[model samples]
Target: MQPSEGSRIVVGVDGSPSSHAALRWADRYARGVGGAVEAVSVWDTPSSRGWSGPAIDPDFDLGQARELFERELHEVFPDGLPDGLTRHLVEGDPSEVLIRASEGAEMLVVGRRGRGGFARAVLGSVSQRCAQHAACPVVVIRQQDDPAR
Candidate 1:
Protein backbone atom coordinates (compact mmCIF):
# COMPACT_ATOMS: atom_id res chain seq x y z
CA MET A 1 0.00 0.00 0.00
CA GLN A 2 1.12 3.59 -0.60
CA PRO A 3 2.16 5.61 2.41
CA SER A 4 0.16 8.67 3.36
CA GLU A 5 1.96 11.94 2.84
CA GLY A 6 1.67 14.86 5.19
CA SER A 7 3.11 18.28 5.96
CA ARG A 8 5.46 16.63 8.42
CA ILE A 9 9.22 16.60 8.35
CA VAL A 10 10.68 13.37 9.74
CA VAL A 11 13.99 13.50 11.56
CA GLY A 12 15.89 10.46 12.82
CA VAL A 13 17.22 11.24 16.25
CA ASP A 14 19.55 9.08 18.36
CA GLY A 15 20.66 11.55 21.06
CA SER A 16 24.06 11.87 19.46
CA PRO A 17 25.42 15.34 18.86
CA SER A 18 24.96 14.86 15.14
CA SER A 19 21.43 13.67 15.63
CA HIS A 20 20.67 16.65 17.81
CA ALA A 21 22.02 18.88 15.10
CA ALA A 22 19.76 17.17 12.62
CA LEU A 23 16.77 17.87 14.85
CA ARG A 24 17.65 21.52 15.07
CA TRP A 25 18.07 21.72 11.35
CA ALA A 26 14.78 20.02 10.74
CA ASP A 27 13.00 22.34 13.12
CA ARG A 28 14.41 25.40 11.44
CA TYR A 29 13.51 24.22 8.00
CA ALA A 30 10.07 23.14 9.05
CA ARG A 31 9.37 26.54 10.52
CA GLY A 32 10.40 28.17 7.28
CA VAL A 33 8.18 25.89 5.24
CA GLY A 34 5.25 25.83 7.63
CA GLY A 35 5.55 22.13 8.21
CA ALA A 36 5.39 20.10 11.37
CA VAL A 37 8.39 18.20 12.71
CA GLU A 38 8.27 14.55 13.62
CA ALA A 39 11.23 13.58 15.75
CA VAL A 40 11.81 9.85 15.50
CA SER A 41 14.09 7.65 17.53
CA VAL A 42 14.66 4.20 16.14
CA TRP A 43 16.12 1.27 18.04
CA ASP A 44 16.65 -2.47 17.68
CA THR A 45 17.26 -5.42 19.94
CA PRO A 46 20.15 -7.79 19.46
CA SER A 47 19.60 -10.22 16.61
CA SER A 48 20.81 -13.05 18.78
CA ARG A 49 17.77 -12.47 20.96
CA GLY A 50 15.40 -13.05 18.10
CA TRP A 51 13.20 -16.11 17.57
CA SER A 52 16.33 -18.13 16.81
CA GLY A 53 17.35 -18.24 20.47
CA PRO A 54 17.15 -16.64 23.87
CA ALA A 55 18.37 -13.05 24.21
CA ILE A 56 22.00 -12.80 25.10
CA ASP A 57 21.32 -9.93 27.46
CA PRO A 58 18.74 -10.92 30.00
CA ASP A 59 18.61 -7.40 31.36
CA PHE A 60 17.49 -5.94 28.05
CA ASP A 61 13.99 -4.50 28.21
CA LEU A 62 11.97 -3.30 25.24
CA GLY A 63 10.37 -0.67 27.45
CA GLN A 64 13.72 0.98 28.09
CA ALA A 65 13.98 1.80 24.42
CA ARG A 66 10.97 4.06 24.59
CA GLU A 67 12.27 5.75 27.72
CA LEU A 68 15.63 6.35 26.14
CA PHE A 69 13.99 7.94 23.14
CA GLU A 70 12.03 10.33 25.30
CA ARG A 71 15.02 11.10 27.49
CA GLU A 72 17.10 11.97 24.47
CA LEU A 73 14.42 14.24 23.11
CA HIS A 74 14.08 16.00 26.42
CA GLU A 75 17.82 16.35 26.78
CA VAL A 76 17.95 18.18 23.49
CA PHE A 77 14.79 20.14 24.01
CA PRO A 78 14.49 20.25 27.78
CA ASP A 79 11.64 22.73 27.47
CA GLY A 80 9.67 19.88 25.92
CA LEU A 81 8.72 19.44 22.30
CA PRO A 82 8.06 22.71 20.57
CA ASP A 83 4.78 23.64 18.99
CA GLY A 84 4.07 21.53 15.90
CA LEU A 85 6.67 19.00 16.99
CA THR A 86 5.94 15.38 17.89
CA ARG A 87 7.97 12.40 19.06
CA HIS A 88 7.97 8.79 17.96
CA LEU A 89 9.71 5.75 19.38
CA VAL A 90 10.08 3.02 16.82
CA GLU A 91 11.51 -0.46 17.38
CA GLY A 92 13.58 -1.57 14.41
CA ASP A 93 16.76 -0.89 12.52
CA PRO A 94 17.47 2.83 12.34
CA SER A 95 17.65 2.98 8.57
CA GLU A 96 14.51 0.95 8.07
CA VAL A 97 12.52 3.02 10.52
CA LEU A 98 13.61 6.36 9.11
CA ILE A 99 13.05 5.27 5.54
CA ARG A 100 9.59 4.00 6.30
CA ALA A 101 8.75 7.08 8.30
CA SER A 102 9.76 9.27 5.36
CA GLU A 103 7.17 7.78 3.07
CA GLY A 104 4.57 10.34 4.03
CA ALA A 105 6.92 13.08 5.14
CA GLU A 106 7.74 16.26 3.36
CA MET A 107 11.39 15.43 3.98
CA LEU A 108 13.64 13.16 6.01
CA VAL A 109 16.49 14.45 8.17
CA VAL A 110 19.20 12.23 9.57
CA GLY A 111 22.58 12.54 11.18
CA ARG A 112 25.70 10.88 9.94
CA ARG A 113 26.02 8.75 13.05
CA GLY A 114 29.42 7.60 11.98
CA ARG A 115 31.88 5.99 14.30
CA GLY A 116 35.50 6.48 13.32
CA GLY A 117 37.47 3.54 11.94
CA PHE A 118 35.55 0.63 10.47
CA ALA A 119 32.08 2.07 11.04
CA ARG A 120 33.10 5.36 9.50
CA ALA A 121 34.44 3.56 6.48
CA VAL A 122 30.89 2.49 5.75
CA LEU A 123 29.92 6.15 5.25
CA GLY A 124 27.56 6.42 8.18
CA SER A 125 25.31 3.52 7.41
CA VAL A 126 22.05 4.92 8.71
CA SER A 127 22.32 8.29 7.05
CA GLN A 128 23.68 6.82 3.86
CA ARG A 129 20.95 4.25 3.64
CA CYS A 130 18.23 6.78 4.30
CA ALA A 131 19.61 9.24 1.77
CA GLN A 132 19.78 6.56 -0.85
CA HIS A 133 16.33 5.10 -0.28
CA ALA A 134 14.05 7.57 1.39
CA ALA A 135 10.78 8.27 -0.43
CA CYS A 136 11.37 11.97 0.09
CA PRO A 137 14.38 14.23 0.22
CA VAL A 138 16.91 13.27 2.91
CA VAL A 139 19.15 15.65 4.81
CA VAL A 140 22.22 14.07 6.41
CA ILE A 141 23.51 16.24 9.21
CA ARG A 142 27.14 15.80 10.10
CA GLN A 143 28.96 16.40 13.37
CA GLN A 144 30.11 19.96 13.89
CA ASP A 145 32.30 21.84 16.34
CA ASP A 146 29.84 23.79 18.44
CA PRO A 147 29.98 23.96 22.21
CA ALA A 148 26.23 24.51 22.27
CA ARG A 149 25.78 21.35 20.20
Candidate 2:
Protein backbone atom coordinates (compact mmCIF):
# COMPACT_ATOMS: atom_id res chain seq x y z
CA MET A 1 0.00 0.00 0.00
CA GLN A 2 1.21 3.49 -0.81
CA PRO A 3 1.80 5.86 2.04
CA SER A 4 -0.78 8.56 2.59
CA GLU A 5 0.13 12.23 2.39
CA GLY A 6 0.16 12.48 6.15
CA SER A 7 2.82 9.82 6.60
CA ARG A 8 6.01 11.83 7.10
CA ILE A 9 9.09 10.78 9.05
CA VAL A 10 11.32 13.57 10.29
CA VAL A 11 14.96 12.72 10.95
CA GLY A 12 17.82 14.78 12.30
CA VAL A 13 21.18 14.76 10.51
CA ASP A 14 24.29 16.30 12.04
CA GLY A 15 27.12 14.75 10.01
CA SER A 16 27.87 12.23 12.74
CA PRO A 17 28.16 8.50 12.10
CA SER A 18 25.19 7.96 14.36
CA SER A 19 23.17 10.56 12.51
CA HIS A 20 23.94 8.78 9.26
CA ALA A 21 22.69 5.59 10.79
CA ALA A 22 19.55 7.33 11.91
CA LEU A 23 18.98 8.65 8.43
CA ARG A 24 19.35 5.17 6.99
CA TRP A 25 16.96 3.74 9.52
CA ALA A 26 14.42 6.50 8.96
CA ASP A 27 14.52 5.94 5.22
CA ARG A 28 14.03 2.22 5.55
CA TYR A 29 11.19 2.66 8.01
CA ALA A 30 9.52 5.25 5.82
CA ARG A 31 9.73 2.97 2.84
CA GLY A 32 8.25 0.10 4.77
CA VAL A 33 5.39 2.26 6.01
CA GLY A 34 4.87 4.03 2.71
CA GLY A 35 5.82 7.32 4.31
CA ALA A 36 8.01 10.25 3.25
CA VAL A 37 11.22 11.38 4.90
CA GLU A 38 12.14 14.87 5.97
CA ALA A 39 15.81 15.35 6.94
CA VAL A 40 16.61 18.39 9.07
CA SER A 41 20.10 19.86 9.65
CA VAL A 42 20.47 22.77 12.04
CA TRP A 43 23.24 25.34 12.58
CA ASP A 44 23.79 28.09 15.12
CA THR A 45 26.33 30.84 15.71
CA PRO A 46 28.25 30.99 18.96
CA SER A 47 26.83 34.43 19.70
CA SER A 48 23.33 33.13 19.28
CA ARG A 49 24.02 30.75 22.15
CA GLY A 50 25.69 33.50 24.20
CA TRP A 51 29.07 31.85 23.93
CA SER A 52 31.95 34.07 25.05
CA GLY A 53 34.31 32.82 22.37
CA PRO A 54 36.37 34.52 19.73
CA ALA A 55 34.42 36.34 17.03
CA ILE A 56 33.56 34.14 14.06
CA ASP A 57 31.91 34.84 10.72
CA PRO A 58 28.28 33.71 10.77
CA ASP A 59 28.25 33.39 6.97
CA PHE A 60 31.19 31.01 7.07
CA ASP A 61 29.59 28.88 9.75
CA LEU A 62 26.33 28.72 7.82
CA GLY A 63 28.22 27.71 4.70
CA GLN A 64 30.01 24.95 6.54
CA ALA A 65 26.77 23.70 7.99
CA ARG A 66 25.17 23.65 4.58
CA GLU A 67 28.14 21.77 3.19
CA LEU A 68 28.01 19.20 5.93
CA PHE A 69 24.29 18.73 5.48
CA GLU A 70 24.67 18.16 1.77
CA ARG A 71 27.63 15.88 2.26
CA GLU A 72 25.77 13.75 4.76
CA LEU A 73 22.80 13.39 2.41
CA HIS A 74 25.08 12.42 -0.48
CA GLU A 75 26.93 9.90 1.63
CA VAL A 76 23.73 8.26 2.75
CA PHE A 77 22.00 8.29 -0.64
CA PRO A 78 24.96 7.82 -2.95
CA ASP A 79 22.80 6.54 -5.73
CA GLY A 80 20.02 9.14 -5.44
CA LEU A 81 17.57 10.55 -2.99
CA PRO A 82 14.31 8.64 -2.65
CA ASP A 83 11.19 10.03 -4.31
CA GLY A 84 9.58 11.48 -1.20
CA LEU A 85 12.69 12.70 0.56
CA THR A 86 12.90 16.38 1.52
CA ARG A 87 15.80 18.30 3.06
CA HIS A 88 15.83 21.31 5.38
CA LEU A 89 18.87 23.34 6.49
CA VAL A 90 17.83 25.68 9.25
CA GLU A 91 19.75 28.05 11.52
CA GLY A 92 18.85 27.49 15.16
CA ASP A 93 19.32 25.10 18.05
CA PRO A 94 19.33 21.51 16.81
CA SER A 95 16.88 20.31 19.39
CA GLU A 96 14.41 23.12 18.87
CA VAL A 97 14.63 22.88 15.12
CA LEU A 98 14.08 19.15 15.14
CA ILE A 99 11.24 19.39 17.59
CA ARG A 100 9.48 21.95 15.45
CA ALA A 101 10.01 19.84 12.38
CA SER A 102 8.49 16.89 14.13
CA GLU A 103 5.13 18.61 14.21
CA GLY A 104 2.58 16.76 12.07
CA ALA A 105 5.15 14.08 11.30
CA GLU A 106 4.36 10.42 11.74
CA MET A 107 7.53 9.98 13.73
CA LEU A 108 10.87 11.62 14.52
CA VAL A 109 14.17 9.77 14.22
CA VAL A 110 17.55 10.86 15.59
CA GLY A 111 20.96 9.51 16.48
CA ARG A 112 21.62 8.51 20.06
CA ARG A 113 24.62 10.85 19.94
CA GLY A 114 25.77 13.59 17.61
CA ARG A 115 28.87 15.70 16.86
CA GLY A 116 29.06 17.09 20.36
CA GLY A 117 32.11 17.35 22.59
CA PHE A 118 30.72 14.89 25.11
CA ALA A 119 32.22 11.55 24.04
CA ARG A 120 30.89 9.35 26.82
CA ALA A 121 27.26 10.33 26.69
CA VAL A 122 24.74 7.59 25.97
CA LEU A 123 22.44 10.15 24.40
CA GLY A 124 23.36 13.51 22.90
CA SER A 125 21.69 16.61 24.27
CA VAL A 126 19.81 17.35 21.06
CA SER A 127 18.41 13.86 20.72
CA GLN A 128 17.52 13.71 24.37
CA ARG A 129 15.68 17.01 24.17
CA CYS A 130 13.85 16.02 21.02
CA ALA A 131 12.78 12.72 22.48
CA GLN A 132 11.43 14.56 25.48
CA HIS A 133 9.69 17.44 23.71
CA ALA A 134 8.93 16.53 20.15
CA ALA A 135 5.29 16.52 19.05
CA CYS A 136 5.64 13.09 17.49
CA PRO A 137 7.00 9.77 18.63
CA VAL A 138 10.82 9.60 18.62
CA VAL A 139 13.25 6.90 17.63
CA VAL A 140 16.91 7.17 18.59
CA ILE A 141 19.35 5.08 16.59
CA ARG A 142 22.57 3.98 18.27
CA GLN A 143 25.73 4.01 16.22
CA GLN A 144 27.17 0.59 15.54
CA ASP A 145 30.85 0.12 16.29
CA ASP A 146 32.69 -0.82 13.14
CA PRO A 147 35.28 -3.56 13.52
CA ALA A 148 37.68 -1.57 11.34
CA ARG A 149 37.54 1.39 13.67
Candidate 3:
Protein backbone atom coordinates (compact mmCIF):
# COMPACT_ATOMS: atom_id res chain seq x y z
CA MET A 1 0.00 0.00 0.00
CA GLN A 2 1.59 3.17 -1.16
CA PRO A 3 1.11 6.01 1.27
CA SER A 4 -0.77 9.03 0.16
CA GLU A 5 1.11 12.20 -0.57
CA GLY A 6 2.19 14.24 2.48
CA SER A 7 2.18 11.24 4.79
CA ARG A 8 5.81 11.40 5.81
CA ILE A 9 7.35 10.49 9.17
CA VAL A 10 10.44 12.61 9.76
CA VAL A 11 12.93 11.22 12.27
CA GLY A 12 16.20 12.57 13.70
CA VAL A 13 19.22 10.27 14.04
CA ASP A 14 22.24 11.24 16.15
CA GLY A 15 24.04 7.85 16.36
CA SER A 16 22.80 7.40 19.91
CA PRO A 17 20.98 4.40 21.33
CA SER A 18 17.81 6.39 21.85
CA SER A 19 18.07 7.67 18.28
CA HIS A 20 18.34 4.10 17.05
CA ALA A 21 15.21 3.22 18.96
CA ALA A 22 13.49 6.24 17.45
CA LEU A 23 14.53 5.13 13.98
CA ARG A 24 13.14 1.65 14.53
CA TRP A 25 9.96 3.04 15.97
CA ALA A 26 9.56 5.45 13.08
CA ASP A 27 10.08 2.67 10.54
CA ARG A 28 7.49 0.47 12.19
CA TYR A 29 5.00 3.30 12.43
CA ALA A 30 5.57 4.27 8.82
CA ARG A 31 5.08 0.71 7.67
CA GLY A 32 1.89 0.33 9.65
CA VAL A 33 0.51 3.56 8.22
CA GLY A 34 1.76 3.03 4.68
CA GLY A 35 3.82 6.17 5.09
CA ALA A 36 7.40 7.01 4.20
CA VAL A 37 10.25 7.70 6.63
CA GLU A 38 12.69 10.56 6.28
CA ALA A 39 15.73 10.07 8.47
CA VAL A 40 17.62 13.32 9.10
CA SER A 41 21.14 13.43 10.52
CA VAL A 42 22.59 16.82 11.42
CA TRP A 43 26.18 17.93 11.95
CA ASP A 44 28.07 21.16 12.53
CA THR A 45 31.61 22.18 13.22
CA PRO A 46 32.33 22.94 16.84
CA SER A 47 33.69 26.33 15.94
CA SER A 48 30.64 27.17 13.93
CA ARG A 49 28.54 26.54 17.00
CA GLY A 50 31.05 28.35 19.21
CA TRP A 51 31.49 25.32 21.45
CA SER A 52 35.17 26.16 22.12
CA GLY A 53 35.93 22.46 22.04
CA PRO A 54 38.95 20.91 20.35
CA ALA A 55 39.40 22.33 16.86
CA ILE A 56 38.65 19.84 14.09
CA ASP A 57 38.54 19.91 10.31
CA PRO A 58 35.05 20.52 8.96
CA ASP A 59 35.58 18.04 6.14
CA PHE A 60 36.56 15.27 8.52
CA ASP A 61 33.63 16.02 10.79
CA LEU A 62 31.25 15.89 7.88
CA GLY A 63 32.65 12.56 6.78
CA GLN A 64 32.37 11.20 10.28
CA ALA A 65 28.77 12.35 10.53
CA ARG A 66 27.94 10.63 7.28
CA GLU A 67 29.65 7.45 8.38
CA LEU A 68 27.87 7.47 11.71
CA PHE A 69 24.52 8.04 10.03
CA GLU A 70 25.05 5.16 7.65
CA ARG A 71 26.25 2.89 10.43
CA GLU A 72 23.21 3.62 12.53
CA LEU A 73 20.91 2.90 9.61
CA HIS A 74 22.70 -0.33 8.85
CA GLU A 75 22.57 -1.40 12.46
CA VAL A 76 18.86 -0.71 12.68
CA PHE A 77 18.05 -2.42 9.40
CA PRO A 78 20.58 -5.21 9.25
CA ASP A 79 18.78 -7.19 6.55
CA GLY A 80 17.94 -4.22 4.31
CA LEU A 81 16.44 -0.76 4.34
CA PRO A 82 12.74 -0.34 4.12
CA ASP A 83 11.17 0.47 0.77
CA GLY A 84 10.05 3.97 1.66
CA LEU A 85 13.04 5.06 3.69
CA THR A 86 14.95 8.21 2.72
CA ARG A 87 18.03 9.76 4.36
CA HIS A 88 19.21 13.34 4.76
CA LEU A 89 22.58 14.53 6.03
CA VAL A 90 22.36 18.22 6.78
CA GLU A 91 24.75 20.76 8.28
CA GLY A 92 23.17 22.69 11.11
CA ASP A 93 21.91 22.37 14.63
CA PRO A 94 20.06 19.10 15.11
CA SER A 95 16.91 20.69 16.44
CA GLU A 96 16.81 23.42 13.82
CA VAL A 97 17.45 21.06 10.92
CA LEU A 98 14.90 18.59 12.18
CA ILE A 99 12.37 21.34 12.74
CA ARG A 100 12.80 22.49 9.16
CA ALA A 101 12.40 18.94 7.91
CA SER A 102 9.25 18.56 9.96
CA GLU A 103 7.43 21.09 7.84
CA GLY A 104 4.61 19.44 5.90
CA ALA A 105 5.44 16.12 7.51
CA GLU A 106 2.90 13.89 9.20
CA MET A 107 5.04 13.71 12.31
CA LEU A 108 8.51 14.39 13.71
CA VAL A 109 10.24 11.72 15.83
CA VAL A 110 13.32 12.09 18.03
CA GLY A 111 15.09 10.40 20.92
CA ARG A 112 14.84 11.52 24.51
CA ARG A 113 18.59 12.03 24.73
CA GLY A 114 21.56 12.00 22.38
CA ARG A 115 25.39 12.01 22.68
CA GLY A 116 25.39 15.45 24.29
CA GLY A 117 27.01 15.86 27.69
CA PHE A 118 23.64 16.05 29.39
CA ALA A 119 23.18 12.30 29.41
CA ARG A 120 21.62 12.29 32.85
CA ALA A 121 18.89 14.70 31.80
CA VAL A 122 15.50 13.26 31.03
CA LEU A 123 15.50 14.97 27.64
CA GLY A 124 18.37 16.24 25.56
CA SER A 125 18.41 19.80 24.30
CA VAL A 126 17.83 18.81 20.71
CA SER A 127 14.83 16.65 21.50
CA GLN A 128 13.37 19.26 23.79
CA ARG A 129 13.74 22.03 21.24
CA CYS A 130 12.34 19.86 18.48
CA ALA A 131 9.30 18.98 20.56
CA GLN A 132 8.72 22.64 21.27
CA HIS A 133 9.31 24.07 17.81
CA ALA A 134 8.76 21.41 15.15
CA ALA A 135 6.10 22.18 12.56
CA CYS A 136 4.26 18.96 13.28
CA PRO A 137 3.48 16.64 16.13
CA VAL A 138 6.55 15.15 17.81
CA VAL A 139 7.30 11.74 19.32
CA VAL A 140 10.28 11.42 21.70
CA ILE A 141 11.42 7.82 22.09
CA ARG A 142 13.22 6.86 25.29
CA GLN A 143 16.18 4.52 25.40
CA GLN A 144 15.33 0.84 25.89
CA ASP A 145 17.07 0.70 29.24
CA ASP A 146 16.03 4.07 30.59
CA PRO A 147 15.58 3.88 34.33
CA ALA A 148 12.60 6.22 34.06
CA ARG A 149 10.79 3.50 32.18
What's the true lDDT of residue 55 in model 3? 82
C-alpha TM-score for every candidate: 0.78, 0.85, 0.86
Off by over 4 Å in 1: 1-6, 47-60, 114-124, 145-148
Global lDDT of each candidate: 0.77, 0.85, 0.86
Give the per-residue lDDT of model 1 (tens digit) for 1-149: 33233368999888788988888888777877778899988655655435854565523645777787778777777877779889888776678888999997878998776322474356558888888999998888876832356
lDDT digits (tens) for residues 3-120 of candidate 2: 5654999999999888888898988888888888999998888766556566689998899888988888998889998888999999987888999999988899998878777542
Predictions: Cα RMSD each: 4.9, 3.6, 4.0
Please report the candidate that would top lDDT against the real structure.
3
Ranking by lDDT: 3, 2, 1
TM-score of 1: 0.78
Tally clashing residue pairs in candidate 1.
0
Q: Which lDDT tens digits does candidate 3 get at residues 23-142?
A: 888988888887899999989888875677788999999999899889889988899999989999999867889999999998999988787775325455888888889998999998
Native-to-model Cα distance after best TM-score fit, residue 46 in candidate 3, in Å: 1.7
Error of 3 at 122 (Å): 12
